[model samples]
Target: MNKEALKKKLFTEIYDTHWLKLYLHLLKMLDDEDDAKDVVQEVFASLWNNFDAISIHTSFTSYLYSSVRNRAINYLAHKKVVISYEKAEELRDVNFSNAPDIFLIEKELAFQINSEIDNLPPKMAAIFKKSRLENKSYREIAEELDIAENTVKKQISRALHLLRQKFIHIKYYLFFL
Candidate 1:
């Protein structure tokens, strides 16, 4: 199917399945029916705008939740600014800590880790790549490389440790990373 058709399908599916829940969530949080509907529309609009480029690392519901949350925070901030004439800095205490942009980071980290793995010591790289990229078992990799199973396991473990150290900063986001 074409992108247009896929886009329509996605829009319909998400709207059908999640629109009510999302609207209700916004209603509960923002406590205004009009504001809830408006933000919900904005969320769907953004989703439609970025549909071609958006990659869902988790469930579509979760992706929608994060997008909704960020949008809601912005909405509330703007509303607060309008209502109280307060600076944006005053509302920095809002709970916007949970939603990190994961898809792009996951893609970039995979690229970096793949490059790093390719640059590993030849034997270890081969083993690690076979185990991960080729979905080979330790027994199969060892047999193909004429190495012991224990050796294969050790090399893979070492390769993993090195990769972990290199990307240690993202350890906190490992669930989606």
Candidate 2:
């Protein structure tokens, strides 16, 4: 069989063998059906993408379970950030008259960042916008733009580097969350 065929067979077999167990494990841990499904799907997608280079120091079962666990942890971390941001917004509303300097700085920094994004080279700006704003994957963007995936990755990296240089002061606040 050809490389693509072999890869597909491997993925299909592995997915069929472990998908249900992973989904059930995640569902029990997350206690939300949709979130569990999303995490499982993301883990399988990552496995497919990285199959060629994945070195299983342990068994494949162990690898997949570990991936699912890590993804779930990351999902929970992101939810925490969202919750914290929402709480901060609520506090800001309660103390509107005494708003902190940091909030004002954040607002200004957001405007500056948008302006810098607009100033990026056209192709780079387009790729960055699709990836960041539209949440399109690099593969999707490359397919849509008829460019190589590596080119899309490079453009985004360059755009981020330029923006980081321009907004180094607010990097922590903007990038992490």
Q: Estimate each model's TM-score.
A: 0.46, 0.53
How do the residues 66-163 of candidate 1 rate in per-residue lDDT, one tens digit apiece? 88888899999999878775544444333223435545666888899889998999999999999999999999999999999999999999999999
lDDT of 2 by residue, 39-129 (tens): 9999999888888888889987998899999999999999999999999998767666554565776688779888999999999999999
Residue 89's lDDT in candidate 2: 96
* Count: clashes, candidate 1: 0
Alpha-carbon runs more than 4 Å astray in model 2: 97-177
Which regions of candidate 1 deviate over 4 angstroms? 86-177
Question: Which lDDT value does model 1 have at 95?
Answer: 24
- Candidate 1 global TM-score: 0.46
Error (Å) of candidate 2 at residue 5 is: 0.8
Q: What is the C-alpha RMSD of each candidate to the true structure, in Å?
A: 16.3, 15.0
